[model samples]
Target chain A: MAEKSSELKLLSAWFSPMALRAKIALNIKGLEYENVEEDFNSKSHLLLRSNPVHKKVPVLIHGEKSICESSIIVQYIDEVWSNNNAPSILPQHAYDSAIARFWVSYIDEKLFVCAKNIQDAGKSDEEKKPHSEQLEEEMLVRLEEAFNKCSDKKPFFGGNNIGLIDIALGSFLPVLGLIEEINGRMVLVEDKFPGLINWAVNFAANPAVAGTFPEIDKLILFGKTLLKKMGYCL
Target chain B: MAEKSSELKLLSAWFSPMALRAKIALNIKGLEYENVEEDFNSKSHLLLRSNPVHKKVPVLIHGEKSICESSIIVQYIDEVWSNNNAPSILPQHAYDSAIARFWVSYIDEKLFVCAKNIQDAGKSDEEKKPHSEQLEEEMLVRLEEAFNKCSDKKPFFGGNNIGLIDIALGSFLPVLGLIEEINGRMVLVEDKFPGLINWAVNFAANPAVAGTFPEIDKLILFGKTLLKKMGYCL
Candidate 1:
């Protein structure tokens, strides 16, 4: 077994779901790491050097090597730690693993697009309202379809255990909630998607996720202020 | 070692790079399989039943189990046949494996977007000329950057050997070349991106890719007629 590293370091920013996913994955795996927060406005040279291609946060630096992309980082963590002591983030069975990965890919392709639109809506001028709303509606519909496909028996995506799907979806929940609160619109209404709502509740309740989630109030206030400045406020 | 099946089945379409990746992977691995051509317009019940969610192709139905998603299916092939007399597609080193996976993800996200735009342009009407041209330009720029990033290396994305990155990118070359030829545009010019051009040429020279690649002349003619009907062609 490769000796567990005590010198794992994370380059991250507060309120970034991508970074939060990496943090949560590390915590779940019982890996100890120093968290280095990077300013989005004035990104650190380390972050830039670590991920020159994307220069995005949620870069996991282990000793000498750095891994970028949230999902990629999560997979790296799972592969490095071997997922023995920690909960298995990937499905045990190969087929189930494929399914989990499929959903994760779907989340990246579909759900994230909607989330980006909503974020952009709050960041764009009044003229972008039509485009933003169109994107939001499209995303919500897709989310509804995705939620419908889930069986209530599985609290998490992989039947009773939080796996890759949960992490993928959970990472976006904080931002979704913040966006809704700022916009005064409930995108993921509990009444509309009870199962998804319950899933979110249970996911957020997980110690690994709940412990490190960003401050919701801070995110909401920041989002609202940004929206107002962009002339897209309620 | 698991016995290799006498007859393998590939569920795929003509224009899908996702399907093409699987085809190339199987060929590189030197596995002989029965090709099951699928019509995208009216998908066969088998394709739908096998992959209900996406209902898309490149679904490799080995003996009993079915695998969907080009990247996942490729990994599945590499894993199941690890001990067999197949060419090793993935890198042995974990970091290299991660890098290979990263490029695969990049192809799916960035390269696929460009391919989609080019396809959409060829399928649109005359009024959509501006949209098509803009998409073409965007794809060219993105492809240029992608080529530049990989140009420092050898003919392939993984240095000398044709690895997963080559498989991923090669699958799209036929379609990209077809689009460029039909549109009378030089999206992937030799002088502009010689490395990428060389990579594509080497990929096409591969018996696996070259053998299974769709005929560009036929595809170009088909695209022209389709675009003309859609009012896109002059």
Candidate 2:
């Protein structure tokens, strides 16, 4: 099918997991879009006008319309590009779709909150390591169960394809890598969360997202800068 | 289309606006469900098991499947009951549906946060009256614009039918009423937010959610009790 004439533009920021979700979705759907990177400190007028409510990055502009919030943007991409030959990001079945949405919410609300807590703990990596790992372990165990339930032994949450949950969680791979590096240990233990560990590896290796992540070094630098900005020493 | 043989069960609490959303959606779709009211102090095992993550109410059980989260449950109800001869809760078009979802999110995250802050302010009604009114007024102006954009002069966000955004914001009418009553005078001033004031009236009067609200006196009592429990003087 020929791509629609209306050009798609993404107002995004580097090192943003939310923006990465939109990038991966467009890649998976085989859609072409202009990725206009936005500076976090001095945001462009387009970003402000496009997402006036949140005024956040990762606003997907399609022709005259702009969709904000990463998960919503991903869904918009999937729905608007339904005629494309690429696999749909959301599950086709209603029940499965609900389950996918449920876990995606979990990742955004629960999982990422834990990540932020760890990063903002303000203690030396050694001081916060045990508590941080424990906090994440609880969430990881639940996510492992979720991975088993949602993936059903398949390689991806969408069974054979990269789906919403995959994109939502996988977008955090680089940031999680930065956290792991800063903490000097792995939070995603292979023994405790085998399914998720495998899923993470597969997700990063997926063609749709293989090249989507920022370099780990860049992520680490960005994390430090952010934490410093937030008045956290570490 | 025949109704599914499996019965629908909703684990909900009487005083919860979140639970009210599920009720309104089921009502709009003309779906009959057994609403098992849960005690706030001692939640049911079914609710805990169905929604272990949040351990909250408004879990919709259909045969073996249980859907947690109010918005997810509403969407599930819409999809599962697609064959029913009732108006759809979500819009038909993709972009319109996304906009509806965005506003629903705004109501939940932004509008409701303002409501909770007013209720938990701990000041005497007279002391907090102006501040509470101002806090709610700011959100109301944005909601007024959203109403105009989404409803486009129609009676409801769903264009004369009760839709997702309507259920999302409408469920809080009684609570808003409670907040208004406690503050002495109205938060939703008729002059400032004519559309929303009229909408609040129409939404409460709708057959779907007409009799769903708890009595205002009972709501005030509940509000005071909750505030006291949270160590707020008011």
Note the chain A TM-score of all models in turn.
0.83, 0.91
Lowest lDDT sum, 10 consecutive residues, model 1 chain A, at A225-234
DockQ of 1: 0.43
State the lDDT of candidate 2 residue by residue for A97-209, as single tens digits. Answer: 88889998888877777677677746676766665765576777887888898888999878889999899989878867877886788878888778988998899888889
- DockQ, every prediction: 0.43, 0.71
Q: List, residue by residue over B127-154, the lDDT tens digit for candidate 1.
A: 4455446544664455556555544566
Q: What are the lDDT scores of the predictions, listed in order?
A: 0.72, 0.82
Which segments of candidate 1 are over 4 A away from where they belong?
A: A1-6, A122-155, A182-194, A227-234, B1-8, B63-65, B118-155, B182-194, B227-234
Residue-wise C-alpha lDDT for candidate 2, range B48-166, written one tens digit per residue: 89889889888989888989888988998898888788889988888888888888888777777766667765656576555575566567778888898889899998888988889
Lowest summed lDDT window (length 10), candidate 2 chain B: B225-234
Candidate 1: pairs in clash: B125-B231, B125-B232, B126-B231
